[model samples]
Target: MKSNVGSVDRIIRILVGVVLIALAVTNVIGWWGWLGLIPLITGLVGFCPLYPMLGLSTCPLKKRQ
Candidate 1:
């Protein structure tokens, strides 16, 4: 898949995902926190399946010659 997530977006997603996972592991959020893995994976992969459906992207545009 094309990388629709930019550097900052990816960083934020990864951070949030990690926080959620941590909360889940500590039982502060219960099983729902495990869902954080979805963001973590998407961020790491630089792709968001939902963005395509929404026709949105955070990636920077490439310069044309």
Candidate 2:
């Protein structure tokens, strides 16, 4: 799949994911925090499934001939 996540967005997602996971691991939040894996994986992969469905993309447009 194409990467729809731009650099800044990717960073934010990674941070948020790590924070949530950390919170969960430290028992600061509920097990639901484990769901952070979604954003973490998406961020690492640079692709968000919902982005395509929502018609949103932070990635720069590619040049066309």
Scored against the true structure, residue 15 in model 1 reaches a CA lDDT of 95
**What is the per-residue lDDT of model 1 for residues 24-55, given as tens digits with 9 covering 90 to 100?**
99999899999999999999999999999999
lDDT of 2 by residue, 2-57 (tens): 99999999999999999999999999998999999999999999999999999999
Residue pairs in steric clash, candidate 2?
none
Clashes of each: 0, 0
- Clash pairs for candidate 1: none
Q: What is the C-alpha lDDT of each candidate?
A: 0.96, 0.96
- Judged by whole-model lDDT over C-alpha atoms, candidate 2 comes out at 0.96
Off by over 4 Å in 2: none
Could you tell me every candidate's TM-score relative to the true structure? 0.96, 0.93
